[model samples]
Target chain A: MLTLVSRNSPAAPSGNRRRRSIEGGWKQITINRAFLLPAVVVFVFLFIIPLAQGFYWSLTDFTGYNPEANFIGMANYAEILRDPSMLSALAFTVLFAVGTTVIVTCLAIPLAVQLNKVFLGRNFVRSLWFFPAVPSMAILGLVWSYILSPLPSGVLNTTLNNWFGIDAVSWLSDNSLARMSVILVGVWAQVGWHAVLYVAYLQAIPTEYYEVAKIDGASARQQFFSITLPLLTPAMVISSFLLLTGGLKVFELPYTLTNGGPGFATNTITQALITSGVSQGRYGLASALAVMFTIVVAIVGFSQLKVTTMISRRFS
Target chain B: MKSRALRVLALAAGASLTFAVAGCGSGGADDGTTTVSFLSWTGQEQMEPMIEAFQEANPDVRIEASYAPPVAEYIQTLQTRVLSGTAPDVFVVAAENKTNLIQSGAVVDLTGEPFMEGVQSFNLDTYGSDGAQYGLSLSSWAAGYAYNEDMLAEVGYDGIPETWDEFLTMLQKLKDAGHTPFLESVDQMPTTVSAMLGAQTAQMDPAMDELIFSGESTFAEQWTPILEDYNQLYTEDLVSSDVVALDGDQVRDEFANERVAVINAGPWIINAVEEANPDLNWSFAQVPGRDGGMPFQAGAAAPGYAISANADEETQAAAKTFLTWLASEDGVQMFHEATNDVTVTDNFQPEVNPVFEPLVEPIREGELYLPMISWQRDEDRLNIEVVAQIQRMIQGAVSPEQVASALDSQLSGS
Candidate 1:
């Protein structure tokens, strides 16, 4: 509509003048587009080329050792589809991605709101919450494994037994509990960072809006719902996107904690990819899995963006 | 601005010249010494002394060593190098990569090398195909039950039993005495199952893996009974099923702290266990056998040094010289003192810890078997299936027969 208005304006330039203006605009545009060359090069080299190579390898039996692999065509994909463990891995990967995203978002916002208040030692509290994000997930997983071990001597189990006479729980041995433990540990590791993101967004919200709400006799809860929640949609979009993608790509936490057992209960696609490609030397099959996983991630990521955009529009 | 540009170019030229000179210095100094690049599987602290000893003995060969930690990282690094045509002059050929290395002709055959003479045939055969030995393996390792002597004595046993039935009875006795009988990490293949399978194979005319891989037998036919026997540890409620969640370190800690009576372990745990509890009375015993088979261990030759086929003849010869010294008595002694591994070369007797002495003979005599090392092909894939399925069996989600049949299905890719 704006383009149409500009085009139909009554005081438009003459034809020769417009020609000269467009020529000038073309040179300006060329210079501007030249600034994008480095980024384009990086994207091509880092993402697109590797993606294309992976797709090509997906159609062959390129074990990591030899370059002269035979073209096998769809066999790797078919094998993935047929394998029960691979299917289970897919199920758990989706569950983890969706589970952590929802739980973390639900928990992080309230935590962020509480942390945003002018409480005593606010900086210390924020730092305390953010400490879990400092260490690698692999380290956290190792520590949590010992804490949540199923033995009577485990840290959590021993505490429970001492304090409440509770029995040992199979934290990592049972399928459902193992999945839940991994997701919870993931949430523990990431919730602080996401909350910090929310706190940043919360700080950006104009203070005058809340003052005006107070003058209108709005209560704290009413003011929050009307003023704060609507404006935080953009933050939600970014945080949830990050959470979903990180959760999907999770490998180390589950790997160090459960080693994807007691029957692949916490297996992730990335674990399968590494195990097959690097450890088993079945790079072709791993490439096929990677390609499929990429498609899945793209679909989920875009669908999330669409939903978040719709929510943002509704709130706006 | 022109002067600044000239200064930057001059600095860059100086840096390039320095790097070129340093690169030249890394190799032999053109003094008839040949530099052999080695990608070591051992950590730097352990491998450095062995390299120094070898270089001191053979001054003509300068060892340029780089280290990658074992198993996955080392394999991936070496694989990338081999494919990119930048592999070291010598690298460790492990069970994980032996088949691929041999099939791709990435390693030179060391069958007739004098250094290969005193090494055990089992070590040679592990990295060989069709009688062409490729790796000089100087050491072997075995895993068995590392039992706490005090706890076993409390249960009226001085050592681990030699038969499965007696072992189960002892476990029951220990449990009755309010003690944890055994703990074996099922994160990898269970040591108990591997030992039982080894015992079974030792008595078979053709090795069990040979029959199964040759298609004359199936996992269901040969492995179901053993799987059932192993499952007894969990099913009879003697040992906890939570072991599926435990790793070797956790189990070792339990034994070290005297919280568990016995745990399946290898020599690698010796230092940690001793350090954790210096006065802990412990000894290693072969895993008990079943149905009158002899006791055996789950073990294999340690990763061996293989000269790269891609190296030039001179560097390859230098690599060979390194391996020859590595297999010598003095070199083996230094390696043993550094790494605490039982060297299997006949020229040197590795003085093992007294607690670990019982399993050392079997390691030296090559009476060890690990399914991943013995499988003809698809080792990693089959290993993953076995572990997961066995965990499922322990959890009561699958039967022993189903677990064995799952391997058959995995092997057939069905």
Candidate 2:
């Protein structure tokens, strides 16, 4: 997907070859640079400007309506540190991110490997697994709320009652259960998409290496651990990085499912940020929360990437 | 390779050029007619007819109407526009954004405006500060307990009792009769609690908020009894603790199916209840009172229409004409018929739905009580915390005193 060879093509020359090649290389670099100006302009206007404005707002008592705001120093940040709800949200956010990353990765890799094997209706099974990722998270959340409703008349509850005589379970009521329900739904929605990514990488691995391993009397498990696992490191690096970042910034699944309810059991940082910044008029404080949230997510996400990259490098 | 690179650069430049061209707004018409831009908080189904009526009445003013659904999306959309000085000439002033709009001087004061004549004082005062009105509110909504008549009859209770103790007895009787008595969605402030607080505040000289906000009293002292009374439903097992997970819609469905005898609801659910089961017999009642105090309904003044302060004189005049027509007798009647909202204007006595007749008196007299609407400051933040803490109380994790104290802390912090 990424092409570097044509850009790095050496200039063909005979006399005064070194100077000609240097000039040609410089020209190619200039052409490549010309193609990047649009992206640079977009990044500056869209990302950097708003980010700078947020940082500025974070340092003031800007109530979001008034253009004229007082410079309140670090008062908003200090308030955030002392607010128990923000701290609770922070805890849940970390738990959700770590839980979803671990669960989705553990499930997706195995499912991807199984889907890659020759089996009856394998393509159908792959499509079925990938269907959950097709619809928007908000819709899935609404449907799952009905399925996991605490009422006896709820879909899943009725089924369990009829088939097994089980009483209705309070899936989204108890605090810990609500958190687990949100995470479980989140993992269910995401694992299949990551599995699809792994499948693409699986197809790219050469069959000759597996054939050689098989001829050497390597069992199927050995083939997976030795040959297949190492080769899938690149995909693992990409998948886990996406998972870590996406999991940290999640808002919709929990928002539509439980709405950060049962006493803030499923509340995440983004939900708290949006509530403060937009729903509530505390834009200055919301901006401060946003600034701190971005930094923490960056730290967690980058550290995760570095560690995963190192582990994948060992496998490579 | 060079040609391919040039093509890629050309594509990027072309895309940016297109975006720049599209970003510029369309200019006003050359026609003499004044076009007043409006942002509606109501859904299009209800707003379109009203806009049509306004346009028909005043041909000089052409309303360009747009809508963002309440509460979050509308707030965010209007907030950005107001902040950027591109707000519509007319928009709905909702509880979520009213504080910002009023404080930012984004909306014009309409206290003594000619258009505000015959409008309900309570509606105007809800959106106003210190006797200066900013929004022309036309209607108010009341939420109380919707009871199944059959269920009440089965329990030998003709109606919801007046006293809290009697109400508890009726709930116990319903439970003994093998019917789920009550289910209130804990996603927001429970209606029963809001009504009791309203009854108490109605009796106060300076209002409950005035006493609390001015530091003469605290929520812990004012709201503890109400919270304790509300929590009794959960404590005594008259209501399910699983209600912490149920929303208004789910509870409404349970009521519709007769699975629950009563559900805390508002006029918003009437259509849904009827559509789900037209054969079901249901009626609304003021939430029962504590001790001998008169029963009260939990409600608020509906969101009102406000003109932008930034609009030019001619546009503002045109917008005023629209607002005037919207608050007139015909406009209020049309609004009530279209949306089933109880009209609050003095000039218009609306015909409410038969099922919601019990709510008509309170809506007309402006006896609604919504804490977020009446609170002097930090309404949304306090509401989020209050709802969460109340849910915790419902789940037996926190006491009623703790719920009230949480509000006190939230008020102090804000």
Candidate 3:
């Protein structure tokens, strides 16, 4: 409606009158504003409103089942900080985020580089690599649970035992191994998808740069280091940012795989949040944990984004 | 043409928004008859017939029903609906959410209701708080170790032993007979451990959690021995430590395949076990006693039917009718026939499978326990923590004492 009004206000035909030019600019502004209206409405209603409600609930004693609850100041937040389980969850969440980010980035870039090359049955290989990400994480977690089951009946354990005469390894029972198994499955599920993203970015880079490097007596390794690696930095920036945030909020994989057990070895903050808020009816404390989690994630995500962007710019 | 297309798009969008708004509204009709909306945690196949039966019996009350799958999903759906003031007139109050439901006054108090008469007091009190009943629980479930008859006979035992030592001896004999002795899923609380603790706590002056929360006793003191006794399977190398990574389904499968002679299971597994190996003879028994304590089973009242306190008088009345009918012998018999749950109403005795005959008396008499159902407060949080710590204990990362103290810390922190 505003776009139509602004369009009609500019009445001068073809002539560059100042009033007409001003109205034309107004017409452009109105169109842009009109285009953004739906998104802004969605953002305010879906994101901003819920966030404000969460912030309010964090300061209240809302038990999730009740609509009427008293404001309790910062007791929930204070309690969360003092809680040991939350601290353990926080530690593992950070470790998972950082570990998955570093490891997946290292693996994805190389995988993408290889996937970019022409080979026999290249499409099949690419599809095979990408298939893990196609299924939901919950399904993958269940599948991996069976594959990595500590029993000799598990697929991998049975293979190891029958083929090599090895004892069954307690893949998800030990604390360190549980954490590592979760991260390993996480890395496996993610590396292909991120590599696919890198593959898209790799396609965008001009062939001339690599061609020039090749012509200048550059080895395959040197060409990759000088050109391909530099060009893939933007993908790295986006990929790492996503991995960091998603890893921080991860619940299902760890939940289905080990249920944050063998104790709270692989428990993430979001799992804590869900268990407290949804399952345990401690919505107030969960909201507080959520608020703290959001702040931590935002700080880490934004800082990592800034660092990666700077690095990418330097490389460019 | 472009302008026409834009107009068409706008019309479609407006129509969709209208449909979306209309779709989100409550489905219960109000056409002179009372329409009581019900949300069931049980699946539609189990609940639909009951709704049909209720609607047939009470023509003035129209029954509208929906379902959310059990446990976490059901609790979350009910919670969201209750907080939004859109909860159904009737819903299931599960162990995990009964505390919240009662404390928030979200459920109707069924105290002194005629429908509650003859209903098992244990089932009623499971969802009750402060001497007021909120949920009309109809049936209860008990889980214990189901053993293969042939396997036990091969080891020269006709039935499971009453004491822990004799049971371990039987397990060792089975192992020595070239058979896999036992398997219990440690995904949640171990059945053997919970049952042992249940037997002990049932005999205590005050209930276990009551004494612990009152500061008269500590979990570290009370639970350490139970933990040690339960952990002896692993310590004595009678059961494989790999059971830590197993779940109920896997254990059930192992039993079905005849790879294992015993497994922790409940009536829920009866059909599957029968279907898997009909020729194989199996029977259920309570977990063995320790230190002369009576054998007990890890069990609880089934999640119950509770009316919403916020419902209109008409809907509430209709919901009461539904609950009364549910507690009635006919309703109990139908429910039992459908779900095979041990109905606990005094007037009704659900016919049991011969295999489950051992548990029939206990279920009827309400001699079952689950820590989640019995705990006075912080039940869900404590259960999660305790389960995780127990898993840790099974993995040898933490001692039984540390695991018990973790509960202490969790309770104090909460």
Interface RMSD of each: 0.6, 0.8, 1.2
Q: Model 2: runs farther than 4 Å from truth? A: A1-20, B1-31
Each candidate structure's TM-score, on Cα atoms with residue i matched to residue i, is 0.95, 0.93, 0.91
- Docking category for candidate 1? medium
Count clashing residue pairs per candidate: 0, 0, 0
lDDT for each residue of candidate 2 in B105-174, tens digit (9 for 90 to 100): 9999988887687877889899998778999888898999999999999989888898989999999999
Expressed as tens digits, the lDDT of each residue in A1-316 for candidate 1 is 0010122557978899999988879979899999999999999999999999999999999998988999999999999999899988988999999999999999998899999999889999999999999999999999999999999999999999999999999999899999999999999999999999999999998788887788889999987788788888989999999999988899999999999988888888999999999888899999999999999999999999999999988787
Find the candidate with the highest TM-score and give its number: 1
| lDDT top scorer | 1
Compared with the true structure, what per-residue lDDT tens digits does model 3 show for residues B1-414? Answer: 999999999999999999887555443344556777889887899888887898898887777788899888889999999999999999999889988888888888899999998988988888888789888888898998899989999989988899999999999999999999999998887888889988998898878878987889988999999999988998899998777677888789788878888899998788898999888888999999998889999998998899998898767887888888888887888898888888898888788888988887887788888887888789988888888888777777789999899888888877
Give me the displacement of residue B307 in model 1, in angstroms. Answer: 0.8
Candidate 1 chain A, run of 10 with poorest lDDT = A1-10
Clashing pairs in 2: none
lDDT of 2 at B341: 79
lDDT of 2 by residue, A1-316 (tens): 2121133667767777878787779979899899999999999999999999999999998877778988999999999999888988888898988898889988998899999999999989999999999999989999998888898888888999999999988988888889999999989998999999999988998888878777888999998888777778878878887877788888888888999988888888999999998988788898999999899988997898788788775764
